[model samples]
Target: MTHWRKRYHFLVQITAFSLVLYSCDVTKPYANKQTVPDHLYGDAAADANANMAVLSWKEIFKDPLLQDLIAEGIENNLDLKTAAANLKAAEANFVQSKQAFLPSLSGNASAGAYHPSDAQASNTQVYQLYALSSWQADIWGKLRSTKRSMYASYLASEAYQQAVKTQLVANIAVTYYQLLAYDEQLNIVQQSLEVYSKDTETMKILKNSDVVTGAAVVQSAANYYAVKSTVPDIKNNIRQAENTMSLLLGRTPGPVKRDSLFNEQVYSELSTGLPVQLLANRPDVKQAELQLRSYFEQVNVAETSFYPALTITGQAGLYGTQLKNFFSAGAFLANIVGGLTQPIFNNGLNKQKLKIAQANYEASEYNYSKVLLTAGQEVSNALYQYQMVDEKAQSRQEQIANLEKAVHFTKELLKYTSDTNYTDVLTSEQSLLSARQSAITDKLQQLQAVVNLYAALGGGWK
Candidate 1:
């Protein structure tokens, strides 16, 4: 009884010490950056709250076909599905962690026949049954830390799924527009071929009348064929871009119907909210932060491992020499045990775990910082691109106008000219063709910049 009492007092004192250690949490809560930029873009943004990142996918991508494609991607994308599955598993683990401190109960039954060596020994049957229970006390907050870590992991997986979703939406929009641009280019080239053929006929008439030489007519025909030769390549590129869109929609490679490139309007309200918003809006950044959170909790768990563990175990059951007397009072049996295990030394295993956990926590912090910097850089790049293309689009329109007039004037001059060289007409036509193609590229760039801005601001997931 004295020995038992002393052990009881020792356990009580140990429990008190454990309470003290629990309060001294080695891992601290994560802190935000000391100086987060006010706006993602370098310059001041008016009404930062009026950002397009708040807009939903339906609002940003106004094209009906694109909206439908985004819907299909959210529904059928394999990466999102995988992330969701991982989230489910994490949830299960978290729930299990919540129950870790609770005792476990189990039952068992056994029968045995044994004989002792003697002149006339006989076998006797012994039957036993037991209800066993055990529990571990989480005095050092180990189980709670596990629960916290698991919950963080579950949230991280959810963020990963959202990241995948945002990426898919952006991909579908970009590919659809690329296909449209290719379609427009094909039309432009075909129209140029028609003009070239007409010019070739005029050149032939001039040659017959001795106004131009046969070499001029031949040169005109060659230029017309040169423009015509580009048609097949443009058609192939358009087909491939369409196929890319089809795959994004989780369908077999095929055609994707869309509005003409000229007809598609840019996303409305290209506001790039505050840079601080990236913590919540950018799923990759959010996931990285949550990963930091999980590792932080793991540090606490590792720190707790250096302490002692308290456990209580018990077994109560019925046993007898014969089944007929199993219910007798003598057959009733019960036993209980309590234990404390302090890891004095184990080849530095606990220290190693602590080291690993601290290193991982630090790594997570670094990764989170990198994600923030990357988000800011991308937003800045998109904003600059948007401004550049927006300005160039106006210039492109003016250039297109002047080049049209040049083509018209050069054709008239060639029709009645007594100039030494007819090369000016050919040169003007070539310039016009190049300018028209560049104009198309400018418009496409303007539209593409909008898509990139939306993504950089984390616009699609919502």
Candidate 2:
């Protein structure tokens, strides 16, 4: 009884010593105290409509081909795939972090044959089996704080994956629009070549009649050839565009079949939601915010490291000399132990780590603000560009109509007499061709502007 009392007293003293040495403050940083901008970009609270910025991607992009391509890119784009894998890895880390509060168990078994001098003892076999367990108790909330940090990191990784999805969708849509623009340009060039070829034949007749010198005919022929030369270049461009689109689709270079670019109509009216909503709608902004939260949690974890850790462990096992008797009740044995650990004079490593974590948290805060600012700028720029392009497209349409009428009048006057020189006909033809090309370009620009706005609004990844 005296020995047991002594042992109890010793255990009590050790427990008290450990408690005093390991006692530390585990208070978490005040979340509500961390103030962020109320509005991410422009004044959101002032504009109630900004809250309705979460429009679906389908409503934003009406092009069927564009929607299809975005879907394919999401499924097959390598960057998006890698981001998804990274998210999975982060989730695994979070799971492991949560397990830190749980006990770990291990078992060991050993058997050995020993031989002694004949005069001392005979040979014998000895067998031993045991189990060990360990656990780190979160008395100071260190493990829980670390687990929360990991959870935040996991959420951040998921946000990053969404950001990747958004980017892939935007890229695929832009590429698709680019291909359509190339098609429109090719069509315009082909029509110009046909008209130029007709002019070349007419110049030949004029030269034969001595109405024009060979120089005029040569000039007309040169113009025709010039227009014809553009055809091969346009075809080359088309092939390259196709190859690029194929690569974006995660496939080998191949022909991309599509309907006429002119037939594809894009929606003209668009709603430019207020910029502040970008914080919620833009994946990159959300990702940055999530990363900031993760950093804050990490700071909490680092601060908690200065506190004490409590652990309780237990193990049970059975052992016997014969294998068949290993499960016998008499061979059963069990033991349990509890402990507390405190860091003492660790050469300032923990202090340095806490400082690093605080610095990192500050960095993340700045990054979040930077991303928010960038998102606002993009939205503003896209809105301005879209509005400007729409006006330009309207003006180009009028210009094309007037140029077409001028071309027809010039051709009619040239057929009647020499009152209007062929030069006038050529000038009008050139003007009409230029106007048509400009109109097509304006249309392409309008489409590109819409793509830009959709991307800026984070409308691609639903």
Candidate 3:
């Protein structure tokens, strides 16, 4: 009795010691250490809460065909599917981590016979069946920290998937806009071809009548060929744009149906909200922060690995020489054990693990900060580009109008007066063509700018 009492007292003392260490072994809560600037959008923004990203992608794109393309890309883009697979994998790992808190049980049964070579030796047979269970107590919070890390990783994967979706939508819209621009440019080139062909014939008639020299006829023919040469290149551009949009939609390379560039309705209010909204709006930004969170939990896990672990194990079985007596009380056997294991030396492995985890945590901090800054840069750049293109629209239209008049005036002078020669008419006609094509390009830029701004503000993937 005295011996049993002493053993119980020793166990009580050990339990008390473990309880005292519990406070220090508790895992720390995660905190957001990243900072946001007062003005993330720079000087290009107006309202504090007018972000266009809050609107659905349909609201911004407005074209039925474009909305269909975005929906198709979101459903079929390979990269987004891959991200989704990764998210599922992370979720599985998180579930496994949670299961670690439960005990494990195993069962086994065996029958064996032993025979000796000597004549006097007799054969012996034994039969036994047993069940065993073991559980590790989370005395140092290591399991808890690991579970938290896996949870963070799962969230990061979800955010990464969203980021891919947002990017894919933007790419499809931009490529479609480029196709429309190419179509419009092709039309302008064909119109100029018609005008130049007429001028070429006019030059020949005037030369035969001696109103203008052969040089005028040669110049008109050269300009006609010059304008005709661009058709193939513009058609090639349209084909390439179509192929790109096809890939985005996960389809074979083919023509993409689209509306006219001039028909696109421009959203008057491109409201970029405050910079701080990026935390909630940008999936890539959220992904980076979640990665940082996972690494923080990993650091905690590493810290806890330096402490001791508590474990409990038990087993119960039936043992008897004869199979018929296996159910007897005398054949029953049972045992249990409880202990603690502390790592005293492991060739500096624990210290190395801690150092690596710390380094990873520090690196994630810098990466998270970099992602946040890049998000702000994208928003600012898109907003500025949209404004720049909008401002240029008026001037570009005026310039095209003036060049058309110049072409008309110069052609009339060449026909009725000697003040302007063939060279002046050719120059004015070339400028008019260039300006018309540039006007189409300007509209394309404006439309793409809005798409970019919407994406930069994390508009898609709702």
For this target, which candidate reaches the highest lDDT against the unseen true structure?
3
Local lDDT at 272 for model 2: 51
RMSD of each: 3.2, 4.0, 2.8
lDDT of 2 at 114: 80
- Pairs of residues at least 3 apart in sequence or in different chains that clash in candidate 3: none
lDDT-wise, the better of 1 and 2 is 1
lDDT of 2 at 175: 69
Q: Per-residue lDDT for 1-462 in model 1, tens only?
A: 696688667667755765665575544555544345565457746355678877898887788987888888888877778878988988898889888867999999999989877876687889999899987777677888888899899899888888888888888888888888888888889889889999899999988998889989989999999998889999999888877777777779877768888888786567776788887788998899889989989999998898887777878999998998998888988766767899998999999999999999989889988887788888888777878878787777888788888788877877787764457777878888888888778778777778787887777888
Worst 10 residues of 1 by lDDT: 26-35
Poorest 10 consecutive residues of model 3 by lDDT? 14-23
Q: Estimate each model's TM-score.
A: 0.91, 0.84, 0.93
lDDT of 3: 0.87
Residue 275 in candidate 3, Cα distance off native in Å: 1.4
* Candidate 3 lDDT by residue in tens digits, 263-328: 998776888787778889889999999999999999999888788788767788998878888889
Deviation (Å) of 94 in candidate 3: 0.7
Q: Give me the displacement of residue 128 in model 3, in angstroms.
A: 2.7
